[model samples]
Target: MILCVLVFVLSSTTLSQQHLSHPINFCSMASTCIHDGRGVCASSPDGCSRRSFLDQCDMYEYNCDYGTQFMTKVSNPCTDGQPDFLC
Candidate 1:
């Protein structure tokens, strides 16, 4: 019984480590490509604000967690038909 408990503990710790060490990325769009909970870097959307943006595309390191919220810039298609207004 003691050995079984130790094995279970070890397995759980390994799993937790794997979960925490995973990389996350930010995709301008949500998809399976951003799976694995790693640090995801995303580029500015089509109609993003250039004054406060990093670049057309960005892939930065980030932590993965349930409490983390990602805000994405969206271009309004009804706008000037160009990547002008951000939604």
Candidate 2:
């Protein structure tokens, strides 16, 4: 019984470590793209102004061409419940 407990603890620790090793990228899960085709839903804070954002895409994303930029810009097709400059 003691050995079983030890094994379980070690296995659980290893599994958790693996999970922490691979942090989830909220960008990859963006329901909609933003800022034209030049931006991604990656984690970015400097480009966003919303003070209550909770997720990466909820506030900002990195613009490959423009460094950090708001998730959305004028003319983007994003709508409500999606990541945008007003998010």
Candidate 3:
């Protein structure tokens, strides 16, 4: 009985440690895609500012990284007046 209790305690501790070391990642479940060369212009949710991305996939990744909800703009807001640049 004592040996069984010891084995159960060790196994439970090992299982808990393994789970903590390898937490589940929900982001990896998102579909992967190849980014096209075409550029994408994304505008802030409030539309006060904008940024450019390498492509649509880049824009999506930026949103995911920042926990933002920026959407693609029809035109490049970065080029409307200021010199061509990326932000």
Candidate 4:
């Protein structure tokens, strides 16, 4: 009886440790956004006059990573006009 109790305790502890070590990554499990094949054109009067992105997601990620907030979406793609920068 004592041996069985010790084994059970050890097994439970190991399982708890394993669970803690391998945490579920909710970010990876989250649904990913689908690309619509439409490019993003953003402009800012103060900063970059005009900029182009492959897609809206790329534009959003760039803003988030760069900590910029002035970029506004344009009605047309950058190819419509001469842009200052392209990505």
Candidate 5:
């Protein structure tokens, strides 16, 4: 049981790193008013809104930094694909 749990943790960590490695460029998307193919733009001049769309494939949040003109994610990409419509 312990071994199984350890393996799961390791795998999950590796997978999470894969998505974050490129660091989705929310700022670029926002500038162009686009998202990961399916994500609708729900960002504001100040930053992301409460109803902002999640990343199409990874389901990550698009966090923006108005001051720096940079963007990031509020959380790690969802391991399990969500919002089935896009999937």
Candidate 6:
């Protein structure tokens, strides 16, 4: 039971890291209106080319400066064929 609990705790932490709520693709961003977030990487004010596997392939959020955290559970495959949609 202890082992199981420990494993669950560890896994949960890792999962959180992969699914933190925030803006993505900062490098390719075309806007800088975003304020900040867990996954938000200081906006470059250029919108964002950033992608991430923060949430499941289909289930994710688009937190543009926390104004709106859009969530979806489906996504088109990246042109580069990255599973996480990261270029």
State the lDDT of candidate 6 residue by residue for 1-87, as single tens digits. 999999999989877655433455422241433433233222213323334333331112244343333333234222433233332
* Model 1 lDDT on a 0 to 1 scale: 0.35
Model 4 gets an lDDT of 0.58
Pick by lDDT: 3 or 4, better one: 3
For residues 1-87, could you state the per-residue lDDT of candidate 2 as single tens digits?
Answer: 999999999889877653312343435534453433432233234433422333434443333333433433332333345443454
Q: List candidate 2 segments past 4 Å from native.
A: 1-6, 13-15, 18-25, 29-50, 54-57, 60-87
TM-score of each: 0.22, 0.22, 0.51, 0.42, 0.22, 0.23
Off by over 4 Å in 5: 18-87
Candidate 4 lDDT over 30-87, as tens digits, reads 2254556577778764544667777666655665566554344664466555445553
Which portions of model 3 show Cα errors greater than 4 Å? 1-31, 75-77, 82-87
Please list the C-alpha lDDT of all candidates, in the order they appear.
Answer: 0.35, 0.42, 0.63, 0.58, 0.42, 0.38
Q: Please state the error at residue 81 of candidate 5 in Å.
A: 46
Off by over 4 Å in 4: 1-33, 45-48, 79-87
Greater-lDDT candidate between 1 and 4 = 4
Candidate 3, residues 1-87, lDDT tens digits: the string is 999999999889878653313332313422474767578787776776678877767776776677666567753434665422443
Candidate achieving the largest lDDT: 3
Clashes of each: 12, 0, 0, 0, 0, 16
Candidate 5 residue lDDT tens string, 15-67: 87534435556455456553455433332334432233454322232344432
RMSD of each: 11.9, 10.5, 13.2, 14.1, 12.4, 12.8
Report model 1's TM-score to 2 decimal places. Answer: 0.22
Best by TM-score: 3
